[model samples]
Each structure stands twice: as structure tokens, then as C-alpha cells.
Target: MTIAIIGAGVAGLSAASDLKGAGHEVVLFDKGRGAGGRLSTRRASTPAGDLRFDHGAQFFTARDTVFRALVSDLETRSHVAKWTPSRVSLAHTGGTWSAEPLRSDDDWFVGAPSMNSLVKGMAEGHDVRWGERAIALSIRDEGRYVQLDTSGWQGPFDAVILAIPAEQTRELLADTSPVLASEAAASVTAPCWAVMLAFDAPIKTGWDVAEVSNSPLSLVVRNSSKPGRGNDETFVLHATPEWTRANVDKDKEKVAEELSGVFCQMTGAGAPSLAAAHRWLYAKTETPANSPYGWDHAQRIGIVGDWRIAPRIEAAWQSGHALAAILID
Candidate 1:
């Protein structure tokens, strides 16, 4: 069967790989410039060599036997690496910073070069169409397909997978699958504002990763310390969900200025050499997914994503794998 998977994220790419291994043809589409979805990365060139930043997910843990094996294989292939940063949770309560006790003990893993590398490796040897935004969904000739915003309708596929975020999925599949659309619409994923800062001079920040609380900023990560990043004092700051929603509409420069100032105060990193901001409308999940994945056998429409399971990189891969397994079976 030919499968048209939307969103070249981990989940969608995972589904495409498994289904192809089972002797099925798979075609993938993504609105983004490349794959990996929230498993994103940013690269910049400065006088201090090239710099990299994982602006989306900082790190992920492997728990499931399947996922553990997958990550191990990636590690063996040098596609991913173990990250053990000096992490501490900080309470910014009362406008002061206090180090709190660590919470989780699980080891974190990140892409070797950047988070997107993991997914890019997964998408290798696949017919992936980038910059293909699905504008609408339709069904005809007893098959389902999506109408690209740029390229008109392309279809007659055996299956269509909605592997994008919940909100985008809801908007795309509202007519084809109303029930799933409603569920997608009901799911709550919070927005986030991420700032990537590159510094020319080294700063004396003792820790590599700091999770902040009771403040507008959420987490501060020293990007240079990652496994395969440049030696510049690069940092990434993530805003809290509440703060992101409140200021999501603000201009990027304005938000960057505000957060860069807060980061300098928090870490004493001094003024950034260069800084950029990005807005993720659906950054993280606020609620857990009740279902691992959704499949309508009659409609031949499947839905899988991190939002379809627990919020994490593993869940997203599992969700897509589950849906593809069911379909292939």
C-alpha cells in the first residue's frame, strides 16, 4: 500500500520507516523547511566558528524497550549522544534565585550535532517533500488525500496520517474525521518563546542547564556544552507557557530584548553578541493523551503524534509506530 504521511517529525518518520520496511511505499510531507518538528535545531556562523542550539527539546530519555534499542542504535551510529549536563532546578521566587534539589534521575539523550539530526537520519532514503504545507483535506475515489497550500490536491493514497500538532491536525481533518478533529481541538498544547543567544566572550556561568521556576523564563541552557556544538558561549532561554501566551503576539525583537535582559540578569552572561527569537504556537502538551494513537480503519485515516500520547520525544515516536503497526497488520 502507498502511505502519505504528513509532518516529517519523529512520529511520522518513524511510521514511514516501519511501513516501508514492511514492503509499503510511503510519501511524507512537512510544512517546515526540514524534518524533526519540535526536535529542532538552529545554526549560526560567527567569528567564533559555527554555533548550534537545540531551541526546542533540550533532551529526551529512553524508557521503553523499543525506544531504548532505537536510541542505542542511534548512539552506535553516532547520530545521537548521551548528555549529562550540570543541571539544577532554581526557584526565582521573591525575585531571587535559589538552587533546589534535583527531581528526575533519568539520563538524557540528544542528537549528536543537533536535535534535527536524529529525525533527519530517520528520514534518509525516503521520499520526503519539504515545504509542503497541507492546506486542506479531502476524499474521493474511495481514497483520502491532502491538498497542499502550494501544490494543489495530490491523492489516491491508501492511507493518510495526520502526524502534525493537535491544532493543525484538527484544522486539517475537521471534515474527514469530525470525532478525531474534536478530540484534537480539545487537546491543550501550550505556546513557548525560545531565544537563542550567542556570545563572543566567555561568561562565568557555572552550570550548563538550569530549570527555573516562579518566573517568566523557564529554562536556560548553555548550548556550547552540548555534545557536538561549537565552543562559543551560546545559550538558549525558554519562556514559561503563561508568559509565552501573554506575549506570544509581541514582535520578536521586543520579546528577544525582554528575555535577553532577563537572561543576562539571571546568569550574568553580559550582553549577547547575537540573539534571535522563535515562537512555537504548540510547544508542549498541557494534558496527557488518553489514546496512544487514533485510527479509523474505514476512512483509512490515522493520527499519531506526541500529542496523541504523553508529551515527550519517545511518545511521539511510539505513537507513530503504533499507528503504522496497526495499519500494516
Candidate 2:
């Protein structure tokens, strides 16, 4: 079977890997410069030296068996490791706390080196085309199936999987499937502003990360504290959803500055040597689907993502792997 899966994120890659393992020819496409959609990582040069920071999706938790199995396998391969972060909350002043990493089970793992490495492992040898943004979809041969961005009608493909955000999947298949489009419209996502910063000196905080509330900042993490990061002082700061929404239309630099200021205040830190901000328009979903996965029209065109279950990497993995099991069956 020939399959086309959109979005090379965790969900997409998981689906592709499973399909490939099932002996199906798969073509995965992503609009980004590389894989790992929200599982992103970036390198920065600070006064201290070069640093690698993961500003998107600091870490993931597992809540499903399929995702747990995948994590166990990743653990064996050394693709992931346990991450223990000192956790703090903003609900109090001069108060601090700590806890274990969020996990589907007792064991939790982070991608070795960075979160992006997980996507790279899933993308080992699949036909992935980066930088190809799918524009539209057209059904050929009278209700057989659809092809993306073209109308020549070459395929009554065995399957088509949309592993992206619901809105994007809706946009691509809007004209062809009204019911699906309407369902997607009902599941909207929230935005986020992730700021990556690098400091010249080591952070003085006793905790590795802090969860902030009632402020512009939502979470602040020491990037160097993660498993595979070197001795550089890098930080990842996330803006509150309300803050991100309020400042979404502002200039990128201005938004970064505002968030950076809030971060400095929260941590009692000074200006960073380097800073950058990324805005995720549909970053996190406000609501989630009732089911762990979605299938459509003879199981030929299925959709899956974190939005299908819950807004987390575990949800995405579960959705993808569950869909793969259904397909294989």
C-alpha cells in the first residue's frame, strides 16, 4: 500500500514508522525546515559559550500503554533517558517544591541530546520531504480518495493519514469532507510564545525549573539541566497562554523582550547573552477528542494527534500507535 502522511512531528513520524514496518510504502511531508514539529531544539551562542536549548515541549509524560511500550523501546536504544527536574510553583512567594518527571507510568524519559532526536530516530529511513507545505486536497475517481495539492488523480491509495493539528487537516480536506472540517472547527487550540535565552554564568536557582502562574511567564527551565546538554547556561521560558494570546500580534522582538523581562523578574536573573522567541499559533489544544484516535472512510484516511486524546506527547504517541494497530489488524 502507498500512504501519504502529513506533518513529520511525533504523531506523524510514529504513524509513518509503524506503516513502514508493516511493509507499506510511505511518504511523509512537513512544512518545517526539519522534523520534530513542536519537539524543537535550537543552538545558541552565549558569553559563557555555545549552548543547545529546547524551547518547545520541555518534556513529555506517558499515560497510555502504547506510549509506554514505545518509551521502553526508546530507553533500551538510549534514545531517551530519565529527567529529574526540581519543580517549583508560582502560587506562593519564597516557597519552592520538587517532584518526579511526569510519566505515563513510574518511568519517564526524555530524548537523548534533545527532544528533536526522538523525531530523527522515528525518521530513520522513511521518504520524508521537508519544506513541502500541502496547499489543498482533491478527490479523484469519484469518491475513491484525495491527493494533496494536485488533481491528476494518480492514487486510490491504500491510506492517507493526517497527523497534524486538526485545523490544518481540516484546511487541506475542507472541500472534500465537510463533516470532518466541521469536527476540526469544533476542536480549537491555544497559542504560545516560547523564548530561548542563554546566560553568561550559571543560574543560581536551587531548582532546575519553575512553573509560574499569575504572571506573563508560565514555565522556566534550565536547558543545561536536561540529560544530554553540556555545561552551558541555557534557559527555556514559556509565556502564559493569556499572555501569549494578548501579545500574539505584537512584533517578535518586542514580544521576546517582554517575556525575557518577565523571566528575569521571576528568576531574579539579569539580561541573557542571547535570546530568541517562537510563536506557535496553534500550540496547545483547548479541548481534546473523546477517543484515543480517529478513523474515517474505510480506514483509508485516518487522523491522529495529541488533540485526539490529550494535549501531550504521550497522547500523540498513543493516537499514532493505536491507529497503526488498527491499520495492521
Candidate 3:
């Protein structure tokens, strides 16, 4: 069977890996320049030096047997390592508390060098098209799946898996699967603005990660402290969903300026040496689909992501694995 998995993120890559292991020929496609959708990392110029920031899905956890096995393999290659973060959660009522949920001796992990490396390692020998955008998905007259890309229509596959966000998959599959479309469309997503800042000199921020409250920012993470990143006082400041929604259409520079000022005030990090901003329009799903994955019974189209289950890397991997198993069975 020829299986087409859309979105080279964790879920898509995991599905492709599992399907191939089951003796099915698989092809993975992603619109991003690199794999690992939310699992992104980038280098930025700073006075101190070049710093790396994981601007997307920060870190991942292992919960399932398959994911554990995969992580074990990644660990062997030095593509991932354990990370203990000092997490602080803010209460809705304006109270704050620090906990060690993210700091574990045995259950936390981050991609070595960068989170995207894990996906790159997973996609070693797969047929992955990094810059290809899947324009359409359909079931042909003859019981076969077909995917339309920017170049042309390519298909005649036995099965298709969509591992992107629910909203995006909904847009592509609505014509062929109204039921799947309706369900996915109903699952609204939250947005977030990540403000990346680089400092010229080391700032005296006592903690590596700080959870903020009653402000536009949600969490602030010190990127330089991560295991595999370079040594520079760089930070990733994430805005609250409410703030991101309110300022979605505003100019990027203005948003960056405003957030940088707020971050300096919050942490007393001083003026940033360099700054950049990113908007995750579908940062996470507002509501879950009550299942780990979505499938069109008659169309042979399957959708899976963290939004399909819980909002986490582990959930995304598990959802993809389950969907591929069901499709290949």
C-alpha cells in the first residue's frame, strides 16, 4: 500500500515511520522549510554570540511504549537528551506557584542541538518533500486516494493520513468528507505570539524559566540554559492567547517592541541585543475531538495531531501511531 502522510511534524513523521515498518510505501509532505511543524529552532545574531532558540513546541515528554522506543533510538544517536526545567504555573486568580513537573530525573526530553533534529533523524530514509504543499486531498472514482500538490495531482495511493492541525485538515477535506470537516471545523484553536530576544551581556535573571501573570506574556524561557543551545542570554517570550487574538493584525515590529518592553520590565533583562517575533495562528486547539484521531470511513482519509488528543508532543506521536496502525490493519 502507498500511504501519503501530510505535514512532516511529529505526528506525520511517526505515522510515516509506522506505516513503513508495516511494509507500506510512505511519502511525507510538509509546507515548512524543514520538518517538525511546531518543533522549530532558529539561530539569531546577538552581541554575546550566536544563540539558538526553540521558538515552537518547547520540549516533549514520553508516555507511550512506541514513543519511548522511538526516544530511546533518538537518545542513542545523541539527537535528544533529558532536560529539567524549573516550571512556575500562574493561577487564574493571580496566585503563583513553582513546581517540578517539568523537572524530572526520569521523564523529560529535549532535542539535542535543536528539537527539529529529532524529526530530521526520524525522516532519514523516508520520501519526504520539505517545501511541498498539499493543495487538495480526494478519493478517486476507483477506491484509491489522491493528493493534489502545487506542481500537479499525484496519487493512486491506498491510504492517506493528515497529521496537521484540525483546522487545516478540515479546510482540505471538507469537500470529500463533510462529517470530518464539520467535526474539525468545530474544533477552534488558540493563537500565540513568541517574542525572541537576545541580550548583549549576561543579565542576572535568577531563574531559567519564569511564569508570568496578569500581563500579555504567559511564559518566558531562557534559551541559553537549555542543554544543547549556545551560551547566550537569549529568551523566548510567549504571549497569552487573549493578547495574541487582540493584536493578531497589528504590525510585527510594533508587537515586538511592545513585548520587549514588557519583558524587560518583567525580568529586568535590560535592552535586548536582538529581537524577532513569530505568530502561531493555530498554536493549540481550544477543544479536543474526544478521540485520538479523525477518519473518514468512506474516504480513507485520516487526521491526527496533538489537537486530536491532548496538546503535547507525546499526544501527537501517539495519535499518529494509532491512526497509522488502524489504516494499515
lDDT of each: 0.86, 0.76, 0.81
Best by lDDT: 1
Cα miss at 171, model 3 (Å)? 0.8
**Count of residue pairs whose backbone atoms collide, per candidate:** 0, 2, 0
C-alpha RMSD by candidate, in order: 1.5, 3.3, 2.6
Tell me the lDDT of model 2 at 188: 75
- Number of the predicted model whose TM-score against the real structure is largest: 1
Candidate 3 TM-score to native: 0.92
**For residues 109-138, what per-residue lDDT tens digits would candidate 3 score against the true structure?**
888888888888888889998878888876
TM-score, structure 2 vs. true: 0.89
Tens-digit lDDT string for candidate 1 (1-329): 98899999889988998999999989998998886678888777777677777999888899889889988988988888998888888787787778755646787998988888889778888999999999887788868778988888888798899898999888888889887888788789999999999887887767788888888899988888889886777889999999999998999999999999998888766789888999989999887468988887778888899998787999999998898888888
State the local distance difference test value for candidate 3: 0.81
Clashing pairs in 3: none
Give me candidate 1's TM-score against the actual structure: 0.95
